[model samples]
Target: MSGEVRPRRADAQRNRERILEAAEAVLAREGTSASVRAVAGEAGVGLGTIYRHFPTQEALYQAVIVDRTRRLLAEADRPSPDPGTAFLTFLERIVVHAAQKKTAADLLAGSGVDPKAGTADVSRDMRQAIGRLLTAAQEAGAVRPDLRAPELLALLCGVCLAAERDEWSDELRRRALDVLFDGLRPRPLS
Candidate 1:
């Protein structure tokens, strides 16, 4: 056989997408405890197909992380008339997504993945994009001048953790976000 890799056929591509979707669901539900066989079952495909697409659990998990991160980054990159509103909207979306995928997010955070690694480029880009948004909001006087991007990111992570509780509803999340947003707003003279 030639050493060159051939492009996937349409059916093969479909199978691969299915496997990825299934893997994302399994990971979100089961975290690192999810198995390849379980994902194959969820995808309605054989184990061989999953192995062909993703040879290892780490590869599959990384693919899911990359896919989600790209989506979040894309949302952050979109332009808005009001940079402050845009940043807050992006934060809400991230919190909701993170809450829904808490298990998978936790695994990725705890996995000791190196930030300087090639696979972490998207994560780095996300941080930069968020930084730009925060700066824009600060310049507009929409957020506190003292606030930093890293602090906002850490705050969002904390909100996501709070959102993971079984009793946490969308209304509660909104209220929590509102409180957080209030803290970010510029304070008036006493």
Candidate 2:
């Protein structure tokens, strides 16, 4: 065989991506039980193409979950100033992203999908990030100085819930962040 890479798998790979994209779109617009025919229609591909890539709806669903998880990890990697703001911003982005996908919204209800992907020490890593912000806020007298990262994450999840409501207001997000930040900051010296 020549040293050149073969193109035989290109069409198959494209078809697979199309199926996954369609699954994400359909599952987001519809729900986890979205019909395979709808997914294929969204992808503009034949039914066989989806079937060939994902033999069952479960397999397709799992693939879309993993793909979205990867995207979440990517978004989490963005940089921000201070740990508190960074964590809140990251949480905000993820919550908004989740709002776009019904499957992920369903994930909030104890689904198997990894909530915090990226590493074995996800908790430690995130805590450290939050800790940094907490420490800074405390030192600067901006936050309560006693809030823990896990607690903060729990609040962030709460914010996600608030964000998921039908009202869809950016002000709600700001208010939620403000509330969390207020409790997380240290009291000013008398």
Residue-level error in angstroms, candidate 1, position 190: 1.5
What TM-score do all the candidates reach, one by one?
A: 0.83, 0.62
* lDDT (Cα, tens digit) per residue for candidate 1, span 82-138: 988987887787778777865323422322448544456666666677679889888
What is the Cα root-mean-square deviation between model 2 and the actual structure?
A: 5.3
Whole-model lDDT for model 2 versus the true structure?
A: 0.62
How high a TM-score does candidate 1 get?
0.83
**Poorest lDDT segment (10 consecutive residues) of candidate 2:** 104-113
Per-model root-mean-square deviation over C-alphas: 3.3, 5.3
lDDT of model number 1: 0.76
Candidate 1, position 165, lDDT: 42
Clashing pairs in 1: none
Estimate, for each residue in 1-190, the C-alpha lDDT of model 2 and write its tens digit: 5788766588899888888888888877766668988988999999888888776777788777766665665655555456555555665665666556644343333223354442223334443544565566556555566766557666665555555544356676667666765666565676
lDDT values, one for every candidate: 0.76, 0.62
